[model samples]
Target: MNLQDLQWGLMMMVVGMGTVFALLALLMVVLMGIGRLDRKRPHLPPPPAHEAAPAEATPTVHIVADGLDEDQVAAITVAVMTHAEHRRRLAAPETRAHAPGSQLFASRWLAVGRGRESSPFPRERR
Candidate 1:
């Protein structure tokens, strides 16, 4: 409508926006501090978290086995790696006791020869 009304509306909007932004920034800072705290002192390690003893234990699945085609083995390794990562992500360590997905990521890396025990490369890189 009038310039004065517009100015008032704009000023109010600016104040509202500034307040919302300040609150959001404060929240972000708090979360970052909490994240740093969590990193500094993790409640529990990933593999076997601190929880009530379960009736059964987790089984370690081995991938080192005599297989048919080389392609098949490669494909299987890739699949296992993907599966492990997905599983780890699906399970949170502290709340859920453990995450298998993290191990899956490790297994995937291992399968791809990025781990401690890896398959020999066909030829040296250039």
Candidate 2:
């Protein structure tokens, strides 16, 4: 290539790279300005006084099951506790005692389809 052509290509390359870097720098500055503005704004007001009373902490319950090791028991306990907490949050305060039936001990495979017709992948579909 001629010297002039090479110089022109180099100039174009520099201009393109400079444009990209300028845009990125401008974007960063804009984002930082927005963050500073957000920091300057006042914090949100606290929740209304009527709803401000703290919720009562629920006591932990333990389950003793036969034939389960300590690790299994711990896992089951955590799962049950989390489920109970979730249910309590969703239920009305007046009907809080309504414990749902325990599916924790239920067999998952009992209702699973066992026949060839129940296969997830069928050759015909493929």
Candidate 3:
């Protein structure tokens, strides 16, 4: 072949070899990326366990209340119970014992007249 034809053939060969080399390089990079992904390790702490506080020794105390008797205890209990019941009633709306014909129930709405007869409002307690 002539020098021009030989020159063209050489150029073609070089370009073909260059294309093959570029593909090889690209495959090597892809393989390296896959290896790096597989080698990647996720760092995480283990699940927590129930840990209890150590027991402590506190001083034992014995207290004796003076000047208290059965009558005082009964009175105190009754007062406290009554107060608690009052608070319980006040916490919610006060409810009346349902006695429709009772004198106490009848006396309240006498001033307001029969217009309030159908009402179920709680009695105004003292």
Candidate 4:
């Protein structure tokens, strides 16, 4: 390319890069301003203690298994209880409901297909 063409190319590159950087900087400032505005809003006090619901007692579970011994059954029960407790503690009050079963099944199937058993090449017909 000629010197004029090279100069034009360089000018275009600089202008394009500068525009992107300027937009990013502008976005950062706008986000910070929004955060500040949110922080400045008045805070509401939580409801008094008496209005809160009373804690419920844990329910008993009955399991019937033919082959398992007492120790094995106890271990399974403990594992289940620990898992339930962990889920209760970690779950968020405002979290969305679980996704549909079809979506979950499709995702799991895709995951299994992508696992170690997957082959890069297609199988030939017999």
After TM-score superposition, what is the CA distance of residue 115 in candidate 1 from its true location, in Å? Answer: 62
lDDT by residue (8-70, candidate 1, tens digit) is 999999999999999999999999999888785546756966675566667554555574466
- Checking candidate 4 for backbone clashes, the offending pairs are none
TM-score on alpha carbons, each prediction = 0.32, 0.33, 0.34, 0.32
- Kindly provide the TM-score of model 2 when superposed on the true structure, using C-alpha atoms: 0.33
TM-score of the candidate numbered 1?
0.32
**Candidate 2 runs further than 4 Å off:** 40-126
Clashes of each: 4, 0, 0, 0
Model 2 weakest 10-residue run by lDDT? 108-117
Ranking by TM-score: 3, 2, 4, 1
lDDT at position 23, candidate 1: 100
Q: Please write out the lDDT profile of model 2 over residues 1-126, one tens digit for every residue.
A: 999999999999999999999999999999999999888667799876665335655654454568676678989899988987887688845545544655454465643544344776745864
After superposing candidate 1, which stretches have Cα over 4 Å from the reference? 41-126
Per-residue lDDT of 31 in model 1? 100
Query: Which candidate wins on TM-score?
Result: 3
lDDT of 4 at 72: 81
Candidate 4 C-alpha lDDT tens digits along 10-121:
9999999999999999999999999998886676787666653446545545545776766789999999889877776776333425544434446766766776367767
lDDT of 3 at 96: 45
